[model samples]
Structure formats: C-alpha cells, structure tokens
Target chain A: MFNIFKLAARNLRRYKRRTLLTSILITLGVVAVLLFVSVSGSFKAMMIGQITDSMLGHLQVHSRGYLSSIDSLPLHLNMKGEQVVRVKEILDGNDAVEAYSMRIRLGAMFSNFTETTNVRLNAVDPEQEMQTVPMLADRIIKGKKEGLLAKGEILVPELIARGMKVKIGDTIVLVATNKHGSVNGQPFVVRGILEGISGPGGRDGFIHTDDALALLRIEGREISEIAIRLNEMEQMHEVFDELKGQLESSRNKMDKPVFEVHTWEELSPFFNIARMIDLMTLFIKIMLVAIVLVSIMNVMVMAVYERINEIGTIAAIGTGPGKILSLFVAEGFLLGLFGTLIGVVISLITIAGMNAAQISFDFGRQKGLLLSPTIASGEVIVIAGIVIAIAVLGSLQPAWKAAGMDPITALRHV
Target chain B: MTLVTAKGLEKTYIAGDITVRAIRGVDFTIEPASFVCFIGPSGSGKSTLLNMIGCLDPPTSGFLEVAGKDVTHLGAKESARFRGDHIGFIFQDFNLIPVLTVFENIEYPLQMVQNWPALKRKQRVNELLEAVAMKDQGGKFPNQISGGQKQRVAVARALVTNASLVLADEPTANLDTETANRIISLMKQMRDEFGTTFIFSTHDHRVVKSAEKIFTLEDGKLQQQGNGDNHV
Candidate 1:
C-alpha cells in the first residue's frame, strides 16, 4: 500500500504543469466555500444576537390568544392575576431560566402638544427588563443606559421622537382606553430615544410597569407577556419545550391552555432570511462538489490515456487490475488532499487577518458593529472530507477503464 | 518435466463481421530450463503465440499449459495471479516505467503482485540489480540510462518475482548488434544461475544463432523446428 501511494505521487509529479493547475482549481473552490461559510455565518450569528438580545429575549410566553392579536396589543387577551402567577412559577422552577421580564403591551396616543400619533408601548420593570434583554440599553441612542426607564418616564422610538419633534427630558402625554371602556391620560418625561430594529417590534416604545398599571386603571397584577433569558442561548429550545409542556397543562375556567411559549425564531421575521443564508451555503457546497468532480475526472482520464504503454507493461508483468485501479484513484485522492490542506490554511489566515483589521459594518440603525468571522473545526473537516470523497468518485470511471485494459492491445498502443 | 505445453492452439479476432486469425492451430512443448526461440517474418504470429503462452491473451482454441497448469481458459483475476506466480515478461521496447527508479521498477512485481515484506523486497531487488550489472545504477531513472541499460533494468524487473518462465517478445529488436549479443549472453547466464526457462521471439539471425532450439512460424502455423546452427 505504501509503495502504491509513492508510485501514485510520482506519477502526479510526472506532469507538473497539469497537476499544479488542477490543484489550483480545486484549491480555489475550497477557499471560496470556506470563506463564504465563515463570513455569512458570522453575519447571521451577529444579526441574531442583535435581534434576540435587544428585543425578542430568546423566548417569550404569552396568554393563549395574545400573539395572534399581538399587532393590535389587545388588552382583553392579557393574562389575569392567577394565570400570571402560574406562569411565573413554572419559569422560576426551571434551572435553565436566568431571568425574565413581565410586560404589559398596549396601544396609546402620543402627543407633543402640537402633533398626535398612535404608538405601541411595552410597560416593563427597568431592572428585570435589562437582565432579560441586556442589549436593550445598547440600543438607547440618546439617553442613559444604566437606569433604562424610571417610573413616570418613557423611552420613545427614534422615528416617533423625530416625527413629533420631541427630545429627552421633554414631557409627553399618552392617552389610552382600558378594557372596561374607560379612557385615561398621563404625562411622562421622555428618558431616551431608541434605535429601531429591522422587524416586528421595530417601532414600539418602553415605559415603567407601575406607571402603565396606574394609567390603565388595572386592579391586579395582570400582564400581557413574559420575555425570558436563559443561562445559555443554545438552551432556548430545551427550556421552551419544558415550559410549553408544563404550561399546556395549565387551564382557565374553559379548560383550555392558558399560555403559549415561543422561541425568537418563531417570533421574528429575520429567521427566514437566516434560512436563505443557509440555503445559499448549501448551493455553494454543491458547486464545490461539481468543480472537484470535473477537474479530477478530467486529469485522471488524461493520465490514463497518456500512460497506456506503461500500464500495459505493468499489467503484462503481473501487476493485478486492482492495483492499477488503486494507483490512479490514489493520485486523485492526493490531489484533493493537497488542495484542501492549502485552501484551509489560507482561509484560516485570511479570517485571522480580517479579525485583526476589525472589519465592521452597519445593519439597520446599528452602526460600526464588528464582524467576527470564524469556522468550526468540524465544519472544516466535513468540507475537506467531501472534497476528497468527491475526487475519489470522480476518478473511479477512468481508473476502472485503465485497470480493465487488454494488455496485448495496450502494449501495441504508441 | 515439460514446463509449457500447447496442443492445437488457435486464436481468432472478429471486427464487425470480418475475422482475422492471428494464430492457427499449433502444437508444441517446452522443457524446464531450456533456451528456446520462435522465429518468423512479419505477420507470422510470433508475437501472438508468445502472448498466448504468457497468458496475456487467451487462445481461441488449444490445450495450453504453463508450469504443468492448464491455462487455456482463465478468468482475468485468475490469469493475473497465475502469471504473477509462474511467468515473467520482457517487452521489445524496454518498457520501463519512466517515473520509477531502476530499483523500484524491479521491486514492483514483488511488492504489488506478491505483497512481499519491505525489507525482504529491498534485498531481492538489490540482488537482481547486481545480477543485471546495474547495482550501481539502481537509483537512476529509466530515461537517465542508455538503451542497453534500460533493457537490463527490464530484465531485472521481469525476474524479480522468481517466476519459473520468462518470456521476451523481440527482446533485442531495438538494440545494436553488440548490445543484443550482450543481452542474450546475460539471459543465458541468468538461466544457468537460476534454472529458469527462457523463451523469446526474434527475426535477428545473430540472436537465433544463440538459441539452443528454435521453432519457425509462417502465416500463423509452425513450419519447422531445428537445433541451433541448423538452417531452416
């Protein structure tokens, strides 16, 4: 076996120019795939971090019918006092849960003395909200990140603030209708202006929970939803499943499920775009396969054709057909192996260079966000294995043909 | 004992309704440790006969045996194994693999066909290189050597597996008169030392004079048999 590999290597070296060209082509294909996978993977991960950490909070729980009418911020679908207590109990018992924020979502009318417009608002406790969605303070473009929002204070969306010509420390009036057909108004100081994200919750403002309850005339601890953070982001599904199973069994007077748990993927529209990135990565991998197949097959076929007399001499001297087949296949395998090694090394160096340069780009209203590209070792191994396997497959036909050649006829070939 | 026996051998090739008979029915037997030659003009089936005897080509019809084994109808794998075990071949063009050193070229049959251990294979290859008078040139490639040296390397490669019968098809056709004589002397010496049978085909009268026995063929049929120095 070692002799066969040595002979295969020598044969590849016999045609230096052809071997180099084929190797370069395969190397380029590998480099293209690895680089794309790393860069696009980094982009997707960073964007997901921004969305989940700033707004979605990894997972969310709501009253059974709340999400269906979430856009309208329906007060009638809010979880009552006892239901909220049951949901908290379930969340608090799960070791995976790191923190959670209870929120009251409602639609209100915002006025800056001259202009009035509809605005969606989330009422939260500043400390709990910060723990559940830590990046929330990072999105505060114009005010303090420490306090988030105090009682009687609100964080206005940048779009709404700019449109109403309002700024931090300015007083604004919010008018809202309660579920009982009563209307109330409250004036609050603006604490901050928030940068908008790209999807569903982009235009919502924030306020303190105490202020929200007072203005809505709520008598008890009713809440619209619970946003949850986990000890590890990867544990989102496990915790979500456990909580969902437990909450599904909790029932109201009608004996229907009282709560629905959702991961950030289910709640955000950006996941579709993430899936698109994955699909594109798959297509790139397929293209890499095609490139390896054609290039290695072409080189092996030519090698067989050019070495007919040598093959005949070996075969006539009693070298078996299997040995001949393995010789050619080994050449193809070596080609893939060399190319993949070089490509992976170059890709790693390039990724390191990018990180050193601190390449940054803007996504939506987030500016100068650092892009860190990285590839897992397992991914590198899988890609390399694919290339080498494809190369072996590519050379099989030509190698078989070489092995099965009639020695008498092949010897006569000039 | 007879090392090779072929009775009523025949070979035919077909091409889209046309038939060509390269070798017709023939009968012969070769003894162990004999130096034999098959002589014929062009298109006289000398090579076809050698190919059949070497198991490189199957005869269309005949009783053909090598080393007391009937090889008239062996499968591809069986034929390859049989050839590796009992027969060696040297081609007219000194068809040494260009990519290998002379030492590696000789080691090929042992390593690839017989799966010999590396240390023993190296020792045997060195022995053959010395016997071929190419011991010092073992590290050189085929193209780096002379035509005679290349043929010597081919000779060493053929006998490396210790095959009992070595067949050379027009072995000296490409060499000059002096080199041809030297190669023939080398083969006879190898046969004397190893007790291996040598069979070759040649049109050269000089090579014919050295053979102990000769069989002459014409139009794919055996026409005459004679001892060395006897005219056709």
Candidate 2:
C-alpha cells in the first residue's frame, strides 16, 4: 500500500510540466486564502478591541429602552434604585465579569458665561468608569485623567472646550431638564479636557453622578446603564446568559426582562463592518477552493487519459481496482501536499512583508493603526486539510475511470 | 494438469448499434509449463483469446477455467483479483510504468498483488532481473533505457509474481528481429527454469518457430493446431 504511494509520487515527477502547473495553482490558492484570512482576522481583532476597550466595554447591560432610545437620552428609562442594586449584585456574583460601571446618561447644556452648547453627558463614578473603559481617562488631555471630576466639577471634551472657550479649572454651568419637565442649573469647575471621539456618540461631556443628581430632580437612586467588562472576550456569551438569568429569575412571572443585554457588537454598527470583512474573506476562500478543485481535476483527468495503455498494463498485471484508484488519488494528494507546503512558506514570507510594511487605515476614532497579519497553526492545518481533501476528491472521477476500465479495451485506446 | 481449459467460448459487444463479435466458438486445453503460441494475422481474435485466458475480459458464452478455478464469468473485481493471483501479462509495447525504475517496475506486481515481504521481493526481483539480463539496468527508468532493456524489464515484471500462466500479446511486435529473437530466447530459458506456462499471441514467425505447441487462428476462429518444428 505504501509502495503504491511511492509510485504515484514518482509519477507526478514524471509529468513534470503538467504537475508543476497544477501545483502552482494549488500553491497560489492556498497562499491567497492564508494571507487573506490572517490579515482580515488580525484586522477584526484590532477593531473590536479598539471599540470595546475605548468605549463600549466587552458588553453592556442596560435598562430596557435605554439602548433603543439611547439617542433621546430619556431619564425616565433609567434603572431605578433597587433595580441598580439587583443588577450590581448579579454582576458582582458572576466570575466572568471583570468590572462593571454604573452611569446616569443625560442630555445637558454646557455654558461658560457667554456661549452654550448641547452635550450628551455621562455622569459616571470616576474610578469604575476608567477601569471599565481602560482608555477613557487616557483620552483626557488636561487636569487629572484618573480622578476625572469632583463634585460640582465636569470633564469637557477638547472640541467642546475649544468651542465653548472653556478650560480646566474654569467655571461652567450644568443645565438639565428633569423628568417632571422642570429646568434646573448648577455651577461646576472644569476638571479635565477629554479628546473628542470621532463616531456616533463622540461629542460628550462627563461629570460626577452626584452633580448629575443635583442638576436633575431625581427622587431616589438611579443610573442610566451598566457597562460590563469581562476578563476574556469569549466569556461574553456565558456571562450575558448567567447575568440575564439572575436578573430575570428575581423578577415577577410574565414580566419582560428589566434590562436588555448587548455584546459589544450590538452596541455599535462598526462591528458589522468588521463582520463584512470576514464574509468577504470567506468568499475569497471559496473561490480558492473552486480554483484548486478545477485545476487539479483537469490535470488528473488528462493524466488518466494519457495513461490508458499504462492503466491496462497494470490492470493486466493484476493490480486491482482499489490499488489503481489509490495510485491516481495519491498523485492528487502529493500535488496538494507539495503545493500547500510551498504555499505556507510563501504566505509566511508575504505576511511578514505586509506586517513590516506597517499598513494603516483610519477606523472610527483610531487612526494609523498597524496592520498585523496573524495565521494560527490551527488555521493553517484546517485550510491545508480542506485543500488536500478537495484535491483528492477532484481526482476521484478520473481515478475511478482508470480503475473500472476494461483492460483489453483500455490497452486498445490511443 | 490442465492450467487452462476453455470450451465453446463466445464474445460480442455493441458498437454504435452494430454488434461486433470479437470471439466465436473456441475450445482448447493448456497444460502447465508449456511454451505455446497462438498465431494469426490482423483481426483474427488472437489477442481476444489471450484476454479471455488471462481473465481480463469475460467470455460471452463459455466455460473457461484457469489455474483450476472457473473464471469465465467473474465480475470486474473478482476477475482482477483472479488475474493478480494467477496470471502475468506482457504487452506488445512493453508497457512498463514510466515513472518507476526498472527494479521498481518488476517489484510492482509483488507489491500490488502478492504483498511479498520486502527482502524476499527484492530477492525475487533481483533474481528475475538477472534472469532477463536487466540486473545492471534496474536503477534506470524505462525511458532512460533502450527498447530491448525496457522489454526485458517487462519480462521480469511478468515472472515476478510466479503466476500460473504468463500471457504475452504480440510481445515481439515492437522489437527489431535481433532483439525480438533474443527476448524469445530469454523467455524460453526462464520458462525452462521456473516451469511457468508461457502463452503468446503473435503474427511474428520468429515467436511461432520457438513454440512447442502452436494454434493457428483466422477471423476469430481456430484454423489449425500443429507441433512446432523444434517441439522443445
């Protein structure tokens, strides 16, 4: 059986020109798929990491309607005092949850004596917010990044500060409308200036939750949402399930979930763009499979055609059909193996070149991101396995023809 | 003992709606270790009869047995197994696997059918390579060798399996007279040593002259059976 494989390998070398051409196609297809998958995979990881670590966190648990009507910044949709305690207790109990931050999101007007601007403000606990969004405080350009704002103080984004002519330690008025339609105002010192983000929720201001409560007529304890950070991104689904079960089990029967859970992908439209990259990569791989299948099949069929007399001779010499099939199929298999091995080597060199090139593209609030193409050993194994299997499958028809041939008739074929 | 017995064999096939009768009503008995030849001109079904005796193609209507087993009606797989177990074939073109070295071509049958142990297979192939005068040429591929050397490798390959019957279909057709005569002599010497029955289908008079028993065929039917002049 093993000797049959040796003969098949030798046969490939015998038809050097034909084998080389088919193998080049296989090598090209494998290399294209490997490079594309690696580059796209790295790009996805980077973009998702940027979005999650910068603002969204790994996942978010918000009071129902808060995320859906997040644009309207409805204070009435905020989680109630006891509801906040229940959510916090559930989050604290989950091992997957690395950190959680509570926030009161509100629509506010910022003014520095003369001019005013509408701003979406996140009234956050400074310490927890910084921990949940690891890069949030790093975006602050002035004053302190860690201890962002004190009572009666606000953190204004640089764009907003420049527009309103406000600076760190400058006094500003925080004006808000309560749930009762009552307008209220308070004074705050600007503690830090944050860099303006570039996406949908980019232009925002930050203040202490106490300042937010002081500005708004809130009856009891409440927060707009809780953004959660998990130890690992893969833990999102398990944690979301456990957290949702904990929250729902405590609720009355037949009542809807008090909160809607969203993974980072759900929080922004940007993740979908990342997913589109994967879809495009998959389509390209499918094309590679098609090319390999057609090219190898065509070559093997021609091989069988040219070797009709040889086939008959072997059959006449008492080589059975199964061995005959193995003979030809081994040809295809060796073709794939050689090509894939070469392709992998070539892909590694090409990917190294690409990474060294340090290609960059602007994505959301991030710019000049380094492009890193990474191929996991497992991915190379799986893709190579598929290509080789397809190559063998492509050879089955021609091999079968040779195996089932009538020895006398086949010998008579030209 | 009869190594092969064929009685009232008939073969026919459809070709574009016109049925071509390739063999009709043939009967014969062959003894073990005999050097025999079936002589005929073009389209005489000499090759067809050899195919039937070799178990390559089934007879349409006949009782044909080879190596003490009924083989006329064996299916494709069974027939192939039967051929592998009981027969060796030599073609007019030599038909050596081009990719293999001469030794590898001779070893092909042992590996494919006999599952011979590697050392023993090497021994047998080496012995037969020596027997066919290809001992020094075993390292070379068929294309790298001369036509005579290629045919010599083919002969060694045939005898490697120690099959019950060795069938040669116009074995001398592709060779010049000197090479053809040398090949025939080598085959006869091998037969005298191994006692493997050798059958030939040929129009070549050189092969016919060497046969101990000769059957003449014309138009898919046996025309005569006669003893060779030498009868050795």
Candidate 3:
C-alpha cells in the first residue's frame, strides 16, 4: 500500500504544472462555495433576528377570533383572563422562558396640527417590554429614551413622525377605532423618534399602557396578546408546546375565554424564505463539488495516460492489476484530501476577513451587519464529506483504466 | 524440472476485418538459470513468443506452464502477480520510470511485489546499483543518465524483486554499438551473480552471443535452434 502511494506521489510530482493548475481550479470552486454559504447564513440570521426582535417575538398568544379578523380593532384577546394567566404561569415556570409580556395593539390615525397618517399603535407595559422587544432600544434616536416607558407619552417611528409633522414634545391627537364603529380621541405627547428601525412596527406609532388605554376608552378590558421570549432562539417550539398543553387543559375545565398560541415560525412564515436560501446554497455547493469532481477526473485520466508504460511494466512484473488500480485511486483520494484542507484554510481566512471588514447590508427595507462566519462546524464537515465523495468517485475511471491495461500493448507503447 | 513449458501455444488479434496471428502452434521448454535468446526478423513473432514465456500475454489456445503452474489464460491481476513473483522484463527503449531515481526504480518491484521491509529494500537496491556499477548514480533520475546508464537502471529494476527469469525484448535496440555491448555484458554479469535466467528477443549479435541457447522464428513459428556463434 505504501509503495503504491509513493509511486503515485512521485508520478504527480513529475508534471508539476498540471497538478498546480488543477489545484488552483479546485481552490476557486471551494472559495465560491464558501462565500455563498457564509453570506447566505449571515442573511438568514439577520432576517430571523429582525422578525423576532422587532415584531413577533418568539411566540404570540392571541384570541382566536382576533387573529381571524384584523377588523377586531381595539380587540382584547383576554390573555389576562384566568385561563390565559394559567398558561402564562406554566410558560413562566419553564427555564426556557426568558421573558413574557402582554400588549394591546390597534390601528388608528395620528394627527398633529398640520398633518395626519394611519398607523399601528401598540400599548405595551414598559417594564416587561424590555425583555420581549430589545430591538426597541435600537430604534430610539433624537430623543430621551425614557419616553418609551413614561406614562401617557408616545414614541413614533421616523416615518410616522415625518408624516404627522411631529417631533419630541409635540402633542399628537390619536383617534382609536374599534369593531363597534366607535371612534375615541386622546391626545398624547410624542416622546422620541425610532430613528433607523424599518418594517411595520418601526413605521407605526407606539404608546405606554396608560396612554393607549385612554385613547381606546377601554379602562378595564382584557389584555390583547401575550408575547414570549426564550432563553435561546431554538427553544421557542418546546416552550410553545408546553404552554399550549397547559392552555388546553385549563380550557377543558373552565368556561373562560380561549386564546391561540402561535410560534414565531408561523407568525412570521417568511422565515421559510431564509431556509430556502440555505437549501439553494446547498444545491449550489453540490453543483460546485460536481464540477470539482470532473476536474479531478480529468487530471487523474491525464496522469494515467502519461504513466501508461509504467503501469504496464508494473503489471508485467506481477504487481497485480488490483494493486495498480489501488495506487491510482489512492492518489486521487490524497489529492482530494489535500485540496479539502486547502479549501478549509482558505475559507477560514476569507470568513475572518469578511468579519474583520464588518460588512453591512441594506436590502431595501431590511438592514443588517455581519461580523463573523455564520457557517457552523457541522456544515464544514458536511462540505468535507462532499469533497471526499467527489474525489473517490472521480478516481474510478482512471483506476479502471490503469487496472485494465494490457501488459503486452502497454509495453509496446512508445 | 523445466522452468517454462508451452504446448501448442497460439495468439490471434482482430484488427477490423483481419485476423493477425502473432504466435501459432509453438511448443518449447526452458531449463532453469539458462541465458536464452529468441532471434528473428521483425514481425517474425519472436517478441510474441517472449511475451507468452514471460506470462505477460495469455496464450489464445494451448497450455503454458511456468514454474510448474499452468497459466495459459490467467486473468490480468493473476498474471501480473505471477510475473512479479517469477519474471522480470527489460525493454528496448529502456522503460525506466522517469520520475524515480535509479535506486528508487530498482526498489519499486521489491516494495510492490515482495512487501519487503524498508531496510531490506534499501539493501537490495544498494546491492543492485553496485552490481550495475551505478552505485554513485543511484540518486540520479532515469532521464538524467546516459543511454547505457539508463539500461543499467532498467536491468537493476528487473532484478530487484529477485525473480528467477528476466525477459529482454530487443533490449539493445535503442543503444549504439558500444553502449549495447556494455549493457549486454552487464546483463550477463547480473545473471551470473544472481543465477537469474535471462530470455532475450534480439537481432543484435552481441546479445545473441551472450545467450547459451538461441531460437529463431519466422511468421509466428519457430524456425531453428542453435548455439549462438561468438560474433562481434
């Protein structure tokens, strides 16, 4: 085995230029794949983070009818009812539950003296809001941040503030509408501008609990939605399941109001698009590996052809065609192994460079900055497996050619 | 016992509407440790006969027994192993693997066939290189050597596995008169030292003169046998 490998190594060294050229092609393919996979990973992370941190949280608990009809305006999901509190208690008991908050959301028009625009208004308890929506901190700009928490003070996104011609310290008159066809008006002081936040929540207006209660004229209504946060991003499903089971059990025993539990995945179905991008990246990697396989096949074929006479001579000396075939196959495997090592090193360097460069992204409304390699170690191992499989498969034809050589003809070849 | 025996050996090749017979109805035997040569004009089937005796080519029809094993239609892998254990070959063009140095080329068969220890292979390569008077040139690649030196390396490579018989197919064809004579003499000396039998297909009198027994062929059939004359 060792002798055959040595011979293969020596033969490869004989044509230094060809070997170098093939290695370069392999390296290029690896680089392209690494960049695609890494960037796609970063994009996926950014997208999911944006959705969960800004809007959906990890899970949402709302009244079943309320979710079915957006016209259920100023509607309270009754999450503060006994049954809802039982579910929340169960979730809060779970070690996975990092944070939980109840909020009332409504669509309304906000007007300052000169202008008006329709916007979503969220009424949140400021203390619990920090745990469920940390991204709100990211939105505070051009004003004191305390306005997000202060009683009867409202925070407006840049878009809403611009449309309303309002700024901090300005009073905006908000008219809240409900399914009962009643509209009530309340005036609130604009506290801050959510400077860079984009998307539905960012473009809408938000207020403290007391202010929203005053605007909606609902003094003692049930809480609208229960938003949850998990210790890790992946624990959302398990926690949601536990909370759902608790809610179901409580509902069976009592004639209380019912709520639907929604995980972040369902509330934000577009998360599937991020996964699709990952699949697409994987497909591209497969194609690239195939190309590398073909390139390796060509290199092995040329190596076999060049060593035709040597193979014949070895066969004549009774080395066995099996041994000859194994030698060439081993050569191909070694080439792939070496190329994969090179690829891994190059990928690490490129990832490090990208992270060092602190690349930022702005895709229309979505914004993000990537500062590290998003490729997991498991994914790297999968890539290695792919490279090896390609190498071994690529070696088959060349090894067969070497093994099938006719000793007499090979010896006679000039 | 006869070292090689063939009965009614035959070979046929098809080349697009033509059947070419390279060897036909040949029966022969060779004794152990004999310096033998098959001599004939081109296309007379001397090389084909050598290939059959060396077990490099399977006989189309008939029995071929080498070292008491019948291997008339051995598979490629089997034949290669058989040859590695029992036969070696020297070619006209000096088929030395170009990438390997003289010592490495000589050590190749030992490593591939014998599974010899590294120390053993090293010792055998050194011994063969010294025998060929290429002790100082063992580190040089085949291409870097003179024609005679290349032939010497080829001889050393053939003998590296300690096979009982060596087949030389017009081994001197690529060399000038002086180099050819030197290579022939070295092959003879190697045969004497190792007691390895040598079989050659040659038109060179110098090679024939070195053979103890000579056979002539014509049109895929053996023509005659004689004690070669001491010419050249």
lDDT of 3 by residue, B69-166 (tens): 89897876677778888888898888877877888889878887778899988998999889999999988988789988988888988888888889
Instruction: List TM-score per model, in order.
Output: 0.96, 0.95, 0.89
Q: Which pairs of residues have clashing backbones in candidate 2? A: none
Displacement of the residue A337 alpha carbon in candidate 1, Å:
1.1
- Taking all chains together, the TM-score of candidate 2 against the true structure is 0.95
**Models sorted by DockQ, best on top:** 2, 1, 3
**CA lDDT, candidate 2, residue A93:** 85
Model 1 regions lying over 4 Å from their true place: A251-256
Residue range A294-384, candidate 2, lDDT tens digits: 9889999999999999998888877889999999999988998889899999999999999898888876555667898898999999999
Per-residue accuracy of model 2 over B1-232 as CA lDDT, tens digit each = 7998989988887779799787889889889999999987888888888888988878899899899999878988888888888788888888888888899899988887879898999999999998998778888988899888888888888888888789998899899999999999989988988999999998888888889889888887888887678432
lDDT (0 to 1) per candidate: 0.92, 0.85, 0.79
Worst 10 residues of 2 chain B by lDDT: B223-232
| Model number with the top lDDT | 1
* lDDT digits (tens) for residues A1-414 of candidate 3: 666677777767777888777777777777778778888887777767877886668888877566666443437444455655666677768888888878888887878867777777678888788778777766777687652558867888787777667778888788877545679988878788876443334455568877776766765655777788888988777777877776655443356536678887766656678769978987988887887789889999988887888877777777776788898888787777767778878998889888888888676554565445568888888887788778878988999998888887877676
Model 3 has a DockQ score of: 0.70
Each model's total of backbone clashes? 0, 0, 3
Model 3: runs farther than 4 Å from truth? A1-5, A65-80, A113-116, A146-148, A178-185, A196-200, A210-221, A235-265, A269-276, A334-347, A359-361, A365-377, B230-232
Looking at model 3, residue A359 earns an lDDT score of: 83
User: Which of candidates 2 and 3 reaches a greater DockQ?
Assistant: 2
